[model samples]
Structures are given as C-alpha cells and as structure tokens.
Target chain A: MKTIGKDRFGKIIDKSYFPLLVVFALVTLIPVYILVKISISEPVDVLTQHPTFLIHNFTLEHWEKVLTSGRLWPAFTKSFVVATLTAIFAIFIATPASYVISRLPKKVKYIVILTLFFTRMFPNVGIALPISVKFIRWNLMDTYTGLVLAHLIEQLPFITWILVGTFEVIPVDLEKSAMIDGASRIRSLISIVIPIATPGIAVASLFVWLNSWNEFTYALYLSLSENTLPLQVYYYVNRGGFFQTATYATILTIPVALITYALQRYLKSDYLGGAIK
Target chain B: MKKFFQKYHLEILLILPLTLYIMYFTLLPVLTTINLGFINADTNVFSLENYEYLFGRDDFRKAFSNTVIISILGLIMQLTVGLILALILKKTFKGKGFFRALILTPMGVPTIVSGVALLYIFDTQGYLNELIYRVTEGLKYIGIIASSYKFIPIDWASGGIRTLFMIVFADMWKVTPIVTLLLLAGLESISLQVYEASQIDGASKWQTFKNITLPLLKPSITMTVIIRAVDLFRIFELPMILAGKNTPVIATFAFEEYRLYNNPNISGAAATILLVIIMIFVSLYLKYIDKGEGLA
Candidate 1:
C-alpha cells in the first residue's frame, strides 16, 4: 500500500520485484545486443543461426569493408563537421537570445517561447523539399553549407527553448552583482552567467550535436550526390550487404552512445526541449 | 532610444543575429511551403488545385489512413509501456543507473541507424528466421521434441499491412524510452509528502495511484502523447529503410511524390497536410506545456 515517494530514484513500494527487471532488460538490451553481434560477426555467421549473438569467429572483414568503402570517410566527415558546427552555432547564438526571452515580461515571454517551441517542433522533417528548392536556387544544394543551414532550421529553435530554461535558472542577483561591481553587461554574461549555466548548455549542446548528426530527412532533401553519415548508412543498407550495413550502423552509433553515456548526468528527465517550468 | 539601447543592449546583441537566421531558414521556408502548396508554377495563380489533386489520389488516401492508423497504434504502445516502465524505474533498485542508461541508449543512436539495425533482424532471410529455424533444429538434435513438431519462418517484408506494422514496431523500439523518461520525470516531480499523507490515511496502492499518480501525471501524459503522436505521424526513415520507398506513409508519400513523381504541387499539398496534422498536436502540446503545472 506504499505510494511512490520522492527519494531521487523516486520510490519502491513492494518487497518483491523480478518481472519488471526482466522486461526492462529484454526491451532495452536484446535488440542492441543483436545489432552489435551482427555487426562484428562474419557474413556467413550473420545469415545462419548456429553462432548468432556469440561469436565463434571474430573477423575484421566487415569493418574493413566499411573502412575501405570510400563513401564512409566522406560521410563521417560530413556528419561530424555539420554536427559540430551546428552545435557550436546553436549554443553561441541561441543561448543569449534565450536568456533575453527568459528575462522578458511573462505574457511576452510565453508568446515568444511558445512560438519558438512550435517552430522547433513542426518543420524540420516536413518542409524538406520546399526548402531544398529554395536552397537549390541559391546554388546551396548538395553543399556542406546547405546541409548546415537546413539542419540549423531544425536544431536552433529546440535548443533555444532548452537554453532558455537553462538561463532562467541563473538568478538575476548573480549577474546584477557583477554589473554593480562595474563589470559591463557582456562581461557579466561571460563571467557570471555562462559559467553557472554550463551544465544546461552542455546538455543542450549534446542534444543539438546528436540531432544534427543523426538527422536524415533534411540531409536527404538537401544533399544529392554526397551523403552524410546517416544517409550513407541508408545507402549501404539499401544495397543489401548485411554485415557491412551493420558495421556502418555500429560506427554511426558508437559516438552517440558514448556521448549519451558520458553526458548522461546532465540529461534532465523532462520534455527534451526544456518544455517545463 | 539611446537610453533604451543602453539598458537592453546586451539582450539585443544576443537575440538579433539568431533571430534573423531563424527568419531566413525557418520562417521564409514556411511561407514558401504555404505559397507552393496553393500556387500553380506556370499559371502563377493560387488555388486549391493541389489540395484537390491530393485528395483525389488513391495513394494519398492510403497514406493518410495509414498515417492515422500507425500514429494511433504507436501512441498507445508508447504511453502504456512508458508509464509502466517509468513506474518500475521510479523505484530504487540494484543496478538502477545502468538500467536507466540502457533503456535510453536508443535515444542517442541515429534513427536511420536504428532502422538499419532492425532491418537486419526483420528481413526475410535475416537473423529472426534463422533463429527460429535453428531453435527447432536444436530441439530436434537434443531429442527433446517429437518428430512431428515443425517451425516455419515469417517473411516479414513481403509488403502489406504487416510491413507497416513492422515499421511501427521499429519506431516503438527506438522511441518508447523517451516516453518512459518523460513520465519518470513527472513522477519524480510528485512530492514524497503527498504520498506519505495518503499513506497515513490508509489508502491502498491502487486507490492512491488512481487518485494521486494519475491525476498528477496528466500534463506529462498529455505532453508525451502529443509529442510522440506527431513524431510517429512524421515518420520517414523507418519505413524508408525497412519497407523501401514504395510504402506510402505520409512522410515518405510526400517524399515519393516529390522525388519520384517530380510533382511539386502534390508534394507541397502533402507536406501541407502533414503540417496541419502536426500543428493540431503542437497546439495540444502547447496547452499542456503552458499550464506549466504539477507534471514538470
């Protein structure tokens, strides 16, 4: 009869708990384990059932195939460059704007913030072709800059909301005291506000990087002959080489997995866009 | 004006550049889409012809219905499984941190990569059937089975409603964790004091959950449902990677219309419909997030 009470993990009511753990493990781990095993397994082993999930023979052949595929490095470079640039710009440009919006009067603030949320949520995937045509007219299509601009449309608005939440939590007194001590507004922002807001900024940056890195629909529209990491993975899978496809999938996944795990501490358990009070 | 600039100069410098960038990329594109959806390119006349053409097509009708069906099904699984998992996770347990990370690992993986991963599993001659075939063979080899028992493998990608279902499953695998994490935060925001007060009054677990947890979780519930529903509606890569371009879900349908058919009006019209559908969910989502109330 004990209710869920807050203790950080939140609550534990019953003395006996076995079933939920099993379900959790199966749902969370099984598919990933299968994917990893397939990626490293030999091509024959992948298609056959005998040595599945446990490697009888480990081979770097599939890894070699992906490494030498010629498309892989370019794809990797494209994704990394686009994603890193997107993260840097989103954090630098959006965070200050977010702080300003957060400082506004409540009615104007809600309107502005809500407008940001709507823009962030709605368009990135849906507006691909219309925007692609626009990019093409600018002769921006299929270029790295084109992809970045397309992705910024997707990345900036969402992280702006996230950073706004981040900035709102830094108290006015901290920055005010810095200003009162004759620090200029910009100096106070750099010296006082940014340092305190580091954690939220990091989480927001991780989000922007991951979103830009993994995004597909915009990359599909914006680029044609050249592929980003995600689109290249799709191309390989489309061509039907199981182990090679899995190898690329693994490569695509590793950084994201590392980033999520390393930055795990900062991810607040709310709406991802900081869609909360 | 100079005084005002002096007062808010920092905010202005901060906000202005990014605002212009957003206007160029997002706002301008949005206007162009609305424009393209209505106007004929050659005639330069705005009309409902694109929408009319879209609604008249059989494939568009199919895509619309399929989008509706998949969204509803995916939404149900996400909310139910998410709530249950969040409840399990809210409790303290052994290896809790590890388990939390494991559940959320999918969030970090590129959605396209997840599509590839699941395709490797679900393909006709893929690991799934191989596993099924070998399991029965192993039983036969061990002599624990009668000779009469047989197993046949499923051809999952044979292109039907089942293929659509497979895409839905793939999406659920990738996305359900997000919903769980959202609800977990909502549960975390509920105070220990409330539960303790209820306990003092001797409410049973089910009664307390119904009275306290459910009502308290409404905003999170609404937020998760709308977010996940719109996300599911806009699904592209899962079907594209798993089922190929022929599968006519709304997103891919729009893609096929533009890329394969080379018809901008039809694609624009389809994209506009998707925009309307998403806005409905966005409006609902804004209502809940705006309440900014108990659910965090």
Candidate 2:
C-alpha cells in the first residue's frame, strides 16, 4: 500500500511536469512572438480594437520601409563599428593582462580580480556623464573613438574577468612544456595557450560586441548626432507609430538573435558559473 | 633597474596598458563625478548647493524614493520568479535543453528592445488588452459574467503604480532568465550523491530540499541579489522609454538634469548618490561572500 502510494505520487509528478514547463516556455516566448508578429502584421489587422494573436494579414512593407528609409544603414554602421572596435580593443588589451593575472600569486590575484569586479558593477549613468563631459572638452564628442573608449570602460573589466577565468582553466603545463622546448614565454602563450583559449576569447568578444551594440546611455550623452542602432530604435519608440517602431526594433534585435543562436551551445551554466566567484 | 626590466619586461608590457587604461578612464571618471557633485557650477567653489537644490526639488525626492522602492520590489519579483524557474529547470525532463535555451533567449534581447516590445504589449490598444478582451468575451459566452460586461483597456504607461508595475514586469521579462541561469549553475554544482544519501536516510523530498538544497544555493542567491540589485538601482531605459518624465528614477533624474535642465552639478550629485549606494552594497557583498579565499 505504501509502495503504491509512492508510485502514484511519482506518476502524478511525471504527468504534470512536461505540461507545466511548456506553459512556462510559452510565457517566456510569447512576447517575442508578439513583437515579431506585429512587425510583419498589416496595419488593419493590428491597429484595431481587437488585435488577434494569429497573423491574419502578413506583410513585409514595414521591413522594406525600414531598409529603404536611409536611417537604418547609418545607425547600423555606427553600432557595428563601435561594437566591433570595442570587441577588438577589449580582447587585445584584456587577454595579456588576464593571462598574467591568472598566473599571479593568490592574494595579489584576488585584489586585482576584486578591482575588476567592482568596476564592472559600476552604474553606467554614474560614469557616462563625466566621460561625456570630458570628451566634449577634448573635442572627442560624436566621434567613434569617444564612444569606443566609453564602451571599453565597461567591457575591459568584464572581458578581463572572464578571460582570467578562462586562462585559469588552461593548464600552465602546456605553456611550460613549450617553454622547455626552447620556445619563449611569449611564444608559448601565443602559439599554445591562446589557441586553446580561443573559444573563451570568442565568447567574451561576442558579449562585448553585443553590449556595445545595445548600449544607449553613453551614446545618448556622447553620440548626439550619430545615433547608434539602439538610439535609433529609441527614437522611433518615442515618436514613431507602432508598426515602424516594431520594424526598427526587429531590425535591432536580428543580430542579437543570431549571435544568441550561435551561442546556444555555450550558454550552459558552466560558462557563466564563474561570474560571482 | 635594467636587470629588473629585462626580467619582467613581457609582464609589464602586457599588463601596463590595461591598468593604465582602467585608471585613466574608469577610475578618473568616478573621481571626477564625485568631485563635480560637491562643487558649485556657477562659482567653482566646493559646496553642498547641488545636494541642497536636488533635495529641495519635488521630482528629485520622488525619483530618490522611486528608485529605492523599485529596486527592492523588482529584486523580490525577479528573484522569486527566477528561483521558481530555476527550480523547475533543475529537474530532468524531456526537451529540457530546448526549453532552457528558449527561456534564456530574452537575455540577448537589448534593453531598449525589451522596453519597446513591452510597450507594444502593454499599450492601451496593445496585445495584452486584446488578450483580455478576447478572454472576457469567451467567458461571457460561457455565462461567467454579465452579457453587457466590457473589458476596460488599461493605459499601462500612465504614471504611478501602474507604470511601476509595467517597469518591474518588463525587467522581470528580460532579467529573470539571467538569475535562472546563475541559480541553475549553483544547483548543478551540488553532487547527486548527496541527494541519494538523503533519500537513503528516509528523508522526505521537502525535508531533503530544506536541509540540503537551500543551504548550498545560498551563494548563488547572494550573487544574483547583488548583481540584480546594482542593475535595478540604475534602472534607466525602461522608465525613460515607457513613462518618460511621468516616472523618474535616479538615473533618469540625472539624465534630465544634465540634458534637459543643463544642471550638471545636480546631475553629478544624483550620480554620486547612486555610486555611494552601490558602493555600500558591494562592500556588504565582499564582506559576506569573499571570506578571504573565495575568489582564489
């Protein structure tokens, strides 16, 4: 009788678990679905008293308008350039520092890591104002250099922290073996350790790019005239109609979606597990 | 000196650039903002006039309280929802990976896009209201309410509790996935042997969870709280895009002072205040979690 009761309980759980998860998944995804639906939705279908969840009249006219509108390309280019440059510069500066820090003595490593973590947690608005003010005085305002520098303030510490973790996982024996075989320390790092750390570097760089691409506070303060893609989306959100805003927002999200899709395999908990520690 | 340089030249060359860059950009700006907060913009003399002025303003006070209220409320909401989701995802089930990936997709969506998408849903003539209307109509057909009953579409962007709800809801939609991911990592780190042992000892499921899972999950919970607290304190884009001036948080308040009012002193003061609060939180986190060797 007790065994039967336990089996019944287990059976009840088994019966309910999948459906419960399905509901949760649907709730999580319905917003994105609605956004995408609205973007392709015809005006008559969406701009009404009762907008159906199902797309009754599908059209790409909004997408076409956004493409040909002349605003999309410039904003896209600026965001792309800023994000790409931020990623490249971040990886270049952070990699070596991370490698060295990963090999540092424990106490010293803790302090350095703490400093990076502290800076990473800084409020963006807190620094953005001063940086923009300084950039204005230096005549760096509205320039890609200014924006990239501002982005680096946030990305550098983050990339360094992640890369430090990445480097810690790489056995020092590989580099030591190469060094013993007459390779210099630099050569070993370059030819051996770095190759093994490529995946980590790629993930960090992609995240930096995504962050810079989506950044708005610094862009709002610094890039007054040349808006980034997020700023462009914000502009439409403030003033444009529903369809246009949806279209622009969809365009802004496309690359993010693509990158996230590419990153699905690496989105496991282990990659982000070191975030606190 | 020459011998020392020769010995560690690679290390110095590799590490100096980042150290200098961080000191110049990140550290300098923080110091400058703090400095700017105290100085009088008109006289260039150090004073508390900026703070005085900000404190005297109605909107600034509203923003200050709003920031605190939203941070606490939003943190609770996100943590609860995220914990539930994480607990559910921790269980082994079919298509678990697909569901996990799907749920986490929102993390990649930009904050601005989140605001826009949520606005699309919560706007008066938006999808949410439409959903309500359809559901109510269906219910009316089933004799659940008066046949003449009509659903009143809520203008979710309007200021006050409604706007606050929208902002917190939107934040949850975007950020809860991150908290879930972090907690899942913590959960996965716990070995299966412990659970098996608990079962062998004849502990009930709830007893095992209470005695084992909760204790082990504390670190991840602490980390998520700290991270989310910092982010929530600086809540900006959602409030700015959704309710505009009608709802003001500290970050938005700072932006308004700098841009709309051209009062950099007031803006600097607001920013400095936020920085101080965040510093307190960080220090508390360090003291609690980093009992010397955690990072190492």
Candidate 3:
C-alpha cells in the first residue's frame, strides 16, 4: 500500500484530498439537511428573508398536518403497493428470460443484450403517453395493473440486464449436476440456481422497486385519480407551502434512505459496469 | 421436432412471458407513439400536421434547444465532478467508505424530492441567498463597502439561463454519484503496476493520469456518457418542478401539450423527436458495447 501510494502522487494528494473530500461530502449532505430542517422549522423560519442555516424554531406541526390530513396514507399505500408489485412482477418476468439469455450462444446473447439496452434507453415520456392512451382504452386507467405494467416497461429491461449478469456468474455445471440427479430443468432452476443467485436477484428487485417508487412520468399519466408518493410530493411542491412540501418530501425520502443504507453493500458496480465488458 | 422440443422446451417457456409482455406493452406503445406522431389527430389520416405544428411553436423550439443544450452541459458537469470525486476516493484514505456512502445519499433520494430540496436551497429567500446575505453583511460591517448596499435575492426559479444553470446544478448534485461509482469501478480495474511503471519512466502525476488513467478509463467513460446522455435528454421532473411551465424541456413540453393543451398528437410528435435523439445515443452505445468482448 505504501509503495502504491509513493508511485506517483503521494504527499500533495494525501494533504489535499481530505479537505476536498469534506467539501464534496458537505455539498452532498447540506441540501438533505436543509430539507429535514425545513420540515421541522416554523413557517416564520423557512419563509423569512433571512433563513437560518440551522433550525431556528423546531416544530412538529407540519408533520402532524401531513399525517392527519388523510392525503399521505392513500398515496403512501398506493406507492408501496405499486412498487412492491412492480418489483415482484419484474423479477418474475426478468429472471427467467435473463437466465435463458445468459445461456445463449455468444452472438445471440450479444444481440439480445443490445435489444435490452435499446429498450432501456427509450425515453419514458414518449412511451408513457401511448401506454396511458391504451390503458384508458382498456379501462385500466388509474388502476394498479396499469401503473405496474407501465413501470415494468422500464424495469423489465433494466432488471433483466442486471439479472443476466447475475445468472452468467453462476456456473452452468451446478445446474447440469442437478439435472443428472433426476431434477427437471425447472426444478433445478427453482431449488438450485435461484438460491445461488439470491443476492443478485435481491439486488435486481431492490433496484426495480426503487425505480418504481421514484417513478414520476408513468404515474403522472396512468395514475390520474390516486397519486403515488412522488406525484404527491410533486403536487405539494407546486401548490403547498414550504413547510408542507418539505414534510412530504422528507416523508418520501425516509424509506429510500433506509433501503439504500441497508442494501448499499449489495450495490456492486458490476451491475452497471458489466455492460462495457 | 420432438427432440428439439425436449431439448429447449424449458428455455422457450421461461423466455416466453417476458417476450410477450414487452411486445404488447413496450414495443406496441413505442410504435403507437411514432404512429401517432405522424397522424392527424382529428381526421385520423396520415399527415405531418403534428410535426409541422410543433415546429412552428416558439415554446417547442425552445424546449428542443433546451433539452439538447442542458443535456450536454449537465453531462459534462456530471462527468467532470464525478471523475474528480472518483479520483479522490480511488486512494486509500481514512473515512473513505463513510464519505463514499454519504455522497451516494442524494442518488437514493427520489428525483422529485431532490427537485423540491433544490427549490428550497435556490429559492429567493432560500438558504443560498441567506448565506450570501450574511457574508456580504459581515463584509459591510468591516467598511469594505457602502452600508446602504442591500442584498436582494435572485429569483432562481424564474425562467432564464440562470434557471437552466440551477437545473444543471441540481442534476449534477443528484446524479454525479452514480457517475463516480462507475468511474471508481473503472479505476479499480486499472493495475497499480501501470502507475508504478509510469513513475519509473519519470512521468509526473499529471502526465501519468493524462496518458495512463485517462486512456484506460475510456470504456467506463463511454458507458457513463451513454447512460448520462440518455437520462439527461429526458430530464423531466427537476426543470418542471424548479422552473415551472415557463422553461420547458422536450419532455415537459410533451407533458404540457398532452395534459394542458389536450393535444396527444403534438405531444407524441415532441416525444418522438426525443426518442429519435435518444436512439442515436443508444445506437452509439450499442456499437461501443458490441466492440467489447461479448457478455458471458
């Protein structure tokens, strides 16, 4: 380690990097801190000509208002349900397809992977309009099925891409051995391959869920009557006062923060970096 | 036929559902959007009226330019900031993991939430103005300037180039972490022996990074550019939430046209234009990825 450090740039970097890192860290954190501060601060503190860096008057009135206002829970439940279903369906759909793709010949696999990349890059609003129009025709508007299906358009390719990488890393010999033991291919996949690929599957599902939860465009189109948490937060930001918007935004962020913290260890760059290699 | 069925039946069955779903849901909608873009909304006949109408509008033209300009500007900022941060974290240092995790917190925050948080930070009476006001006030007390000078807050949300800068800054804050992570992965893949070799050849730090690190990090940079370009081109929520309807990007323009103006054809036209731009990036990305060793 010492030799590695001494190889090129040692002393200048060692002395200077710490302060730079601190500045970067503060730049990332201060906005989040202000969000929480405003959520708890009195209106007088937030809407003033000279807002304090720290909370000047801490109060729970905004949170209390948001909670009892009967708006948060519906959107909360709708978002949670939609996100959970999107994750489940995305995993179910993507895992099998990815497993198959992973086993394909090199040329075929490359083409399939490219197709997935293409689909993944399609602008959400472009597709969202057509999907919304179709959903309305099918009488699926403002329904869970509609939003979940819409969310899956993006999540499917993304999750499949991640899971294909996951499935690739698992040795094919493990499945072949199970097949020799009289296990059917499907049974082997269920009992052997999936258990081994649990971590990757977990990562894929985590991302799908997070994407669905944070999704705005599809929800904006399909979810007309009942709002998702993100849509609700957007509404508040547009119409509500600073305190209320802060409270809603803070509420929306808590679950995301907790999930990311718990799963941060699983966030290998391999999931994204695998594409170039 | 029986043997082929027996050999590949499970694979076929496993892959069928997703293929079908994507065909109906994903492919169909994209085709529908393109088709709608080319059709007359009222007469239901094939026409270029929608595109013609969109092209004639000042707001649509502005949205088009804004999307292109902002996406490029934001990607540059994200890449530069991301690379700097990635380099800082590439070394072994005290509290490195803590700082890495800390920086990623913004990425985990929902995009809408980030927009709202940025609004609070950049608003007229927001934290940024307050900080500036205090700094200038202290300078005034030291007789560096006239005491009559008042600190007036700039309306960052108001539509202009300044608002565009706010959008880019907010996007950089929220997105640079992912870029950092991707570049860090690229950095990790570089062998330390390369640096050691360069040092023995008497290369300076800047030279080593310029020649060695930069060249080696190309694939990752390419990957980052593709992802950031695609995502930034469709930047919807931040600009909408920050600048309102006055400063429309292509995505917001489409949304406003559909929802506010009740013109799906025009909206589809704008969206199709965005799709065309994004597809250019996608193809470039695919070509780059194709040049690599095939995925396992």
lDDT accuracy of residue B102 in candidate 3: 91
lDDT by residue (B207-295, candidate 3, tens digit) is 78889999888878878888889889999989878989878999999888888888888889898999999987656665765454222
Q: After superposition, which runs of candidate 3 have C-alpha atoms over 4 Å from their true positions?
A: A1-14, A272-274, B1-6, B281-296
Ranked by lDDT, top first: 3, 2, 1
Give the CAPRI rating of model 3: medium
The residue pairs found clashing in candidate 1 are: A11-B91
Task: Summarize candidate 3's per-residue lDDT along A109-224 as a digit string, tens digits.
Answer: 98988788778777788889988888889998888888898899988988998888889889999999999999988899999999999988987898789889998989998877
* Sort order, TM-score high to low: 3, 2, 1
Off by over 4 Å in 1: A1-17, A48-51, A271-273, B1-9, B130-149, B282-296
Q: Give the CAPRI rating of model 2.
A: medium
Runs of candidate 2 exceeding 4 Å displacement: A1-16, A269-274, B1-6, B284-296
Q: Is 1 or 2 the stronger prediction by TM-score?
A: 2
For every model shown, what is its TM-score relative to the native structure? 0.90, 0.94, 0.95
State residue B216's C-alpha deviation in candidate 1, in Å.
Answer: 0.7
- Residue by residue across A14-126, what tens digits does model 2's lDDT show? 57767877887887788888888999999988888778889999999999998998988999999999999999999999999999999888788888987787886667787
On a 0 to 100 scale, what is the lDDT of residue B98 in model 2? 87
